[model samples]
Target: MTSQLSADYKVDHFQKKATVVGLVGAAVFLFAAVAPYIFATDVTSAWIKLFYLISLATTWNLLAGYAGMVSVGQQAYIGLGAYGIFVFNDMGLDPYSSVLVASVAVGIIAFPISYVAFRLRGGYFAIGTWVIAEATRQIVIRFDSLGSGRGRSITTYTEDAIYRNLFTYWVALAIMGLAIVATFYLLRSRLGVALQSIRDNEVAAKSMGIKVSQTKRIVFVVAAMGAAAAGGIICLQGLGVASPNTIFGVNYSAFMIFMVLIGGIGTIEGPIIGAIIYFLMDYYFSQMGLWYMVVLGVLAILIMLFLPRGVWGEISHRFNFKVFPVGHQVQPLFPGIKLKKK
Candidate 1:
């Protein structure tokens, strides 16, 4: 009798998961199809940039959020994607294709780097990533194929024409859409549940026969892929070339962390909320000069102190709200019984 009850519980668990996934996928596709037309204006350029940055934060959230591996060197992957467009340009492939190539290449390359980074724990891991980013920057700057320091230019698909601009803008929107959808898909899968288990209690998970290291490695690769595509998307919009310093900058990683931290670390939706807040300030603050950054610093502290869970995290806790519902949820079975997956 107990076994039959457990089987029924399992069915209910999967049922809820399916509903969440279907709802999220439909909403994301609808938004992606509409965002381009709704915010199509020069003045709305900030929104474009927000999409790009949110994609970056999403990547970081995937890594630091699920895997519990807080890396500060994700910029290396971003830089690779940025340069990829130019690399493909030189090879005569489409710039958009370069985004794929860059992301795949970074995911591949990260395997070896992960071997090294994983050797360090906590603070050491963060510092090791920075060192890797610095090394990548120096090496790329010396590569003759990519102009040193001066940076190479990407051939605008339309030579600065209207169609080219429109396409570039749409590409940015598509990239963000892809990132959000991919994250949602991963979060609801068996892998996503496994990742959450590891994040919440590693030793407990390991005792239950979970392969913690392998799971983290896979997530690290996913994070790299997302960050790379984000860099490629943003660079495409302005038709600009990426220099080593520009793409792999330490500041790049810092900004990513800032966005993620402010958005709410460990939650997928937090990154998007944080990106919106960030760009809003960036737009208004850039006009105010350095003082705006001071204000931003203050804002970060206030959010941290008052709302450690971040803006969206707090919202979720307060009202069970979610603009981004990408995680699996279990419902209560009975008032007198413990709530589990069922």
Candidate 2:
């Protein structure tokens, strides 16, 4: 009896457009990193806001898009990060150093909270997280050392406004860059594959021996840390104010969900596109009072009706464009030659 051998198969994770897009993206980020040196102070501040928003949205996308963890309590981490800066500053650490410390501390705190939060699933899970965040906010409001309900400022690190703006801008850029890079690598790894699998079908993935709970816990902690880092930068950018109501507000999560949904939920480019759109809308129409919100709501509805998959998702669907290619592409092992199985 004769035996047949199977032909070798190859997979291409990235498309041709990815290389061009990647190079361009890197150049743009480099330019952005030095924006404080090249651009005016107002422009640098605007870019700082953009970067932090992008950071927050990116982490949220990782959690909701890839991990299927629809959390509305990320603002908790943002608040923690912001307040953490105040705590660190009170301990005599510099503002920039405070950003690092606060973000790490929030990340560590998220791991323990995951144990409690992970008990619920689906919509209940989301509500559970929100309740935890509200509880945290209430608890924080009672701490007189943190200014009670009034809030506090990082006073020690306000020596130079110009220097502080520049530092905050740079840190924001770094956080956004790290988030994008880290996410790209994570999606390309085996862990990312498993994460996506879980997002698609939890039961199927669990049956395949994937550690669903553990993997989700990792994602939750990472997302929390990222949002916290953004919060730290945000507090610094706002002249070191750590206002509880503003930083820990539900509005932050609402904005995050809006950006991700409008941009494209499951794709990497979606959040970036969504953030840019959101920033532009806010910058140009923020002065229009209630009309501004009306316009935003109308636009979001239009995108939902027409695009469905989001702006980036629709564009990708139409033109097959993939700036950050995460899907697999299969081709014949031998170009221009077909092999028959024997």
Give the alpha carbon lDDT tens digit for every residue of 81-168 in model 1: 8887888777887777777787788789888888888899888999999899889888878877777887777863666554565566
User: Model 1 clash pairs?
Assistant: none
lDDT of 2 by residue, 1-342 (tens): 754322655667675656766788799888887777888998888888889889999999999999999999998999889888889888999889888888889999999999999999999988888888888889878888888898887778757778888888888998999898889878878889999999999999999999999999999999999999999998988765546888889889988988998999988989999999999888889999999988988988999998999999899888877678776666567666564532
lDDT of all predictions, in order shown? 0.78, 0.88
* Backbone clash count, each prediction separately: 0, 0
Provide the lowest-lDDT 10-residue window in model 1: 6-15
Candidate 1 has an lDDT of: 0.78
TM-score to native of every candidate shown: 0.89, 0.93
Q: Let me know the TM-score candidate 1 reaches against the reference structure.
A: 0.89
Top candidate by TM-score:
2
Identify the leading candidate in terms of lDDT. 2
Candidate 2 ranges beyond 4 A from true positions: 1-7, 15-23, 335-342
